[model samples]
Target chain A: MKKKHIYIYSPSSAVRDKAAYRRGIQRLQALGHEVEVDEAALSTYQRFAGDDRTRVAALSRAAASRADVALISRGGYGLTRILDAIPCKAIAKAIERGTEFVGLSDFTALQCALFAKTGAVSWSGPALGEDFGAEDGPDEIMEACFDDLLQGQGEGTGWRVPPREAEMLAGFRGLHGATLWGGNLCVLTSLLGTPYFPAVDKGVLFLEDVNEHPYRIERMLDQLRHAGVLARQKAVLLGHFTGTRKLPHDRGFDMRTVADRLRGLIKAPVLTGLPFGHVPTKVLLPVGAKVEVAADGRDVFMVWGHRHAPGHRAH
Target chain B: MKKKHIYIYSPSSAVRDKAAYRRGIQRLQALGHEVEVDEAALSTYQRFAGDDRTRVAALSRAAASRADVALISRGGYGLTRILDAIPCKAIAKAIERGTEFVGLSDFTALQCALFAKTGAVSWSGPALGEDFGAEDGPDEIMEACFDDLLQGQGEGTGWRVPPREAEMLAGFRGLHGATLWGGNLCVLTSLLGTPYFPAVDKGVLFLEDVNEHPYRIERMLDQLRHAGVLARQKAVLLGHFTGTRKLPHDRGFDMRTVADRLRGLIKAPVLTGLPFGHVPTKVLLPVGAKVEVAADGRDVFMVWGHRHAPGHRAH
Candidate 1:
């Protein structure tokens, strides 16, 4: 395993679980990686990691760090409101110089905005605390994927669709050179009308959310469809939509119902069962990369080629 | 009160409470309004009042009924998905002929789309079951507002801002002839980037929601702000945002903080305490009407003038 430089910062909520954060940093250090934490990583203002100005400055510091990876401490309720103040160009410059900007949930706002403004790529992957600092330690698969990223060995990712969905996958001709974009559904949908929302037509859009009811999920998808977004996509990928509360009034409606309904509405094939979202056993996905996706039986493969090489610089 | 014809239909979710539906009808009859229920009002398909086609036809029937008003049976998780299939032009035509189409929550989608497509006005008000059919009887203020709509005497509506917010309301110079719009914040935000979203400039945007946390509410408002929607508005009126769950992790963040932050962000005044939303005390406000708004101490008044007159409709 290659030892790498990792810069950890908080651009979202305040760290409510300090123990988890500490464990995460310790875990990364144990893996022989040099981890640097931002000065304002633990700062709090209201429910945010810091005030808008503070968070913006923290981002600037991360971009300037020039580390192997710039990872979020955690994602919560921030970023969306301070989008205009974000330093997208500097972050894009950092990415161009090989800094792998990475995070999920609220981080989707920054990723989508940077892509929209500067066509910069970021990673929709684990947060330090939640994924790495879990009481039982990080999932082995997640760690392996992270290691692949650190070693510059990640070329693609694959997962199997449910048995009942295999037939639908068999009919999919797959897509080539499509932009792989999207992270948290709620965050992405929140950017729909904003300039921050990326325009990636013929792209493969993957989405996941937590705690949102099936109706709200369907509503967000409908918003995408109504905005002519779904029609322009080559395919729509579904990650794990976890923590959805099932109500008796929902009758038979669930994520499956939402997916099935989406399939019926758009020309794009709606593929489900992606290994990602607010779950621990998640895969790292390139947010702004052009990728090829193909399916054989129920197994789906997405390839983006080698993005970085080992011993990628910086002091 | 002048007896008026009322056309009741279900264009969104299915009526889960049959007893409430019966009571609502009976209540309307007792009020001397001749209530004519659409044949498919009680029909159910999954969680919807009916399937998309069925609901669309129901909307058509309501439009063609030529009744004094068209009221929804209830509101639930529907409408946003069926925007494209809705009979907007027909409903707009009905509005021109003085059939005041009215509903809220999920109905915000139809109201917004109609205004966007044809500059037609609808009502951001109560549904039959939830408002008129309460077990303890209807709220007097709500019933009075409905009577005013029926008698074509509704000139405007007013409410007193919370004392903590009174000074801020006092500073408001108010708006003149600004387009009055917005309803059900989530539904309104859902239409943000779509063609169905109204392009109302210098509009008095009134927003409300139920079951959304303060963070979520602020996020939606942020989306509106980021999309340049809030900057385009003359003033922002916040109606009742109820049913928000209290989370200990919120750390003092709530609707009050959300409103305060909004007031600081936008040049327009963020006025709260509008008598509307999922609550029983809601007042009917014309969705797309040109109106004047003025603040007097704690009391804020909005005037849309007389939209309809009594004893002049079809049988």
Candidate 2:
């Protein structure tokens, strides 16, 4: 395997699995890859201490500049705060120089922003949070993501879901040409009017959320529909929105309800129960990658990463 | 107190509070008024299902033909789905006849639509969810809402949230005149590209949310900002976004952060921690009610509406 230089940047929450972060750094070192940990990025104090912004901005720039890969420490609650403040142009230019970015959850804001502002396709995968030093995450997910992005391997496949009888309805057309965009649904919706989320038309939008009720999910979906987002998309792919606390009076508006709502509004195919998002066995997808959605009648297949040669960068 | 007929209409979920709906019915009945329940107006199984759109249209026509009070049951999630289905012309004619309209939350969509389609100032306050229940709601809230609409019994008070602390920054000037609109932040955002949420260039926009985390709140606020909704508002009044479940990282971006984010984006004064929205002790406001926003540094007062007379309707 090629030696990859990964720079870790997280300038928000300092205490979000400190041990795991150190352990990951050790693991990367043991693997003989060059891993740079910018400790300055871990300066966030009690959420939005004014200090975190400057540090986050600086670390974002530094991580993007010299590293072959930029690894966000964890998905914490501080990216959006520093989004406008961060030097997006500098980060974009770094991507132009070729640097792979990776993170999910709160990191989604940064990933989306990188794509929107810089046209850099960033991956949403394991961060230093629950995935690191944990057996919960499938080893295949980690290997597939690293091989595809770092090793510049061909299209990484294997998109599967546990047994479910909900058949894909009439809308699943196996065509995906648009940029793969989205992260946490709630966070993505939050980016509605900001410069972070550029015009998302004809994009295969993917989203996931955790610990929200079905009604709340319905509300967020309603917001997206009202915003004319769902109608504009070519396909709506839902990640596993787990830990959904259903209200007593909630009438079947589960993940299925969300899918139905999207199906009702959009002409595009709406597919739910994807293995990505906040689920344990999550797959990785780049926010800005041009990909294809191959859906047979039974299950949808995500052909992540375009056909890139070992030495070529799409950007 | 004179006897007056009370009609209850909801977008969806508000009908479940049997106590509130029943009390509202009984309150009017005990006062020797004909208490009427618009079962079609109540938010039910399918929201607008069995809503009897034709009858609703006819009722609006009859009431508008005679200038009657038409109270909406509750607010949840159905109005927009029934927009084209609802008899717009009849509702508009009724508003023209000075028929009073009321409701909030999901009902905000309907109320905003009524205002856009017509010119009636719809009232937003205690709904059939709590108004007609066995347990009495705040008397002041009920009196202020119905009294103002029925008999011009109270001032069309603009609206305001008490300051969070003694030391707080205030921006934007005093004494402004624009449209008063908005409801559940998620719901209003949903109305973005649709005909429901018209261009309120310099309006005093009101917003609220329920059960969403801080990041979710920030994301929704971000969406509003991105959609040009936040930047255009003259001033923003935030209501109670209560009991948001704790996210993995509860950053400082609660309601205060939401207000701050709005403040950062727009030159308008952003007020937070209002006793409205999903909270119990909320004040009623009239959407499309042209009112004044007054701020004397220490005190911010929104005073509008006229008070009801003694002989008008049962009080």
Question: Which parts of model 1 are misplaced by more than 4 Å?
Answer: A309-315, B309-315
lDDT by residue (tens digit), candidate 2, A27-100? 67666788876756555554542364565565566646568778767665667666766666777666666776
**A103-187 per-residue lDDT for model 1 (tens digits):** 9999999999999999988999999999999989999988888888887888999999889888888888888899999999999
Alpha-carbon lDDT, every model = 0.91, 0.64
User: CA shift at A57, candidate 2, in angstroms?
Assistant: 1.6
The prediction achieving the highest lDDT against the true structure is: 1
Q: For residues B1-315, write the lDDT of model 2, one tens digit per residue.
A: 545555554444536666666677666566565656554544345333233353345345335434346766556665655554555567665555455666667777777777777766666776655554537444566555565555555564433445552234354456557778877876766565556666777888888888666665775666666667777877777777877876545555456665665666776667765457766566678788777776655566776644233444323
Alpha carbon lDDT at A234, candidate 1: 92
lDDT of 2 at B315: 33
Query: What is the Å distance of residue A163 in model 2 from its true position?
Result: 8.2
